[model samples]
Target chain A: DAGITQSPRYKITETGRQVTLMCHQTWSHSYMFWYRQDLGHGLRLIYYSAAADITDKGEVPDGYVVSRSKTENFPLTLESATRSQTSVYFCASRGTGRGTPTQYFGPGTRLLVL
Target chain B: AQTVTQSQPEMSVQEAETVTLSCTYDTSESDYYLFWYKQPPSRQMILVIRQEAYKQQNATENRFSVNFQKAAKSFSLKISDSQLGDAAMYFCAGAQGGSEKLVFGKGTKLTVNP
Candidate 1:
């Protein structure tokens, strides 16, 4: 309960439908990231936020949208979910400016788009 | 852009034995961080170990240790006295010093045979 968590552990949606995956962390970490894991392609960063109001795109940000209005919540939205978007999505958080830059991840959200 | 590569897609090790998973990376930046993550069937990403490029000494944690070759741009994880609980998908990831994004390699599925 103290670490990061993701909502809707599993979801099924149709193509062209809009869906959102919610990620929340209790640690109030300064750095939060969203990654999608697929077969043959490990984990690719979709988006990352340095702070509440500061966010940037990562390797695979196309067709995915993210916003960080609050430090604890970073939700990923798929405006038009496609079949290729079906994968396990993960949310991670890490504190910056000290120690090891290790990231703690939450239980992934398995999304299936038909 | 930095790229991490895990050559072995799958590996099997007998219980109480040792297993090594290889990982190679390509990065021009001198200072960076490397990490090994373990994901079990539960789909939670757990940090196994970490090594910084700036440090010449290898990093070890309990049964897990990394043979980090800075000159070869290679990082491999060696798990000693492997147990059944160690059966999972292991991933290699890297992040630049000033960047919040982490580049991950295709994971290796390790099976423990008892």
Candidate 2:
């Protein structure tokens, strides 16, 4: 697809296990972000990358790690998944510089930890 | 840190009618941008509209428009001629000019009655 896409649309994992969600965008947006959506809490930024090799943490970055080795790819990893980590993950991207800062999101990955 | 707040958790409107979803955001940044995102049951985050802090005119896209009050830090979305397809969860998000992170509200679930 030409837009952002996430792999493993749905996943089931056990506690203490590791899981990774992949995100890819063809827009070549300079900024890529990951967010988790939970009940009551709409969506919170998990991590963001300004560019390849440049990443930063967001409000809820604990227990989650992200790396952006390429501008088109930004993957999120949960080293040891917990029950509380069960949520829908979203990947978004936007162009940089002087332009519309509106971000476009992926279809989302639903993760369930048992 | 910038925070977005959505007071309405759920709203219902008859098809062909108009409905407004309210959103409030707090930010210390001088220049920022606010956005409205629609997430249907498919879990795809679709950009509905956007407003820049520096622009006095409210942004509109088709049936969707925003009443952005920059001074009050309030940004609300008005969906005119609400259709059954408009029945989805609406989220408000904000990002500063130089920041790559986006803060999203809890979201409001809108239901359209046909």
- Winner by lDDT: 1
True contacts kept of each: 0.83, 0.83
> Interface RMSD (C-alpha) of each candidate?
1.2, 1.1
**Per-residue C-alpha lDDT of model 2 across residues B86-112, encoded as one tens digit per residue:** 999999999898777788899999999
In candidate 2, stretches whose alpha carbon ends up further than 4 angstroms from where it belongs are none
Model 1 segments beyond 4 Å from truth?
A98-100
lDDT tens digits, residues A1-114, model 2?
579999999999999999999999999999999999999998988999989999998889999999988999999999999999999999999898756578889999999999
> Mind giving the per-residue lDDT tens digits that candidate 1 earns over B1-114?
899999999999999999999999889999899999999999899999999999999999999999999989999999999999999999999988877878899999999999
> lDDT of model 1 at residue A27?
92
- Score chain B of each candidate by TM-score: 0.99, 0.98
Per-model TM values vs. the true structure: 0.97, 0.96
Alpha-carbon shift of residue A35 in model 2 (angstroms): 0.6
**Residue A114 deviation, candidate 2, in Å?**
0.8
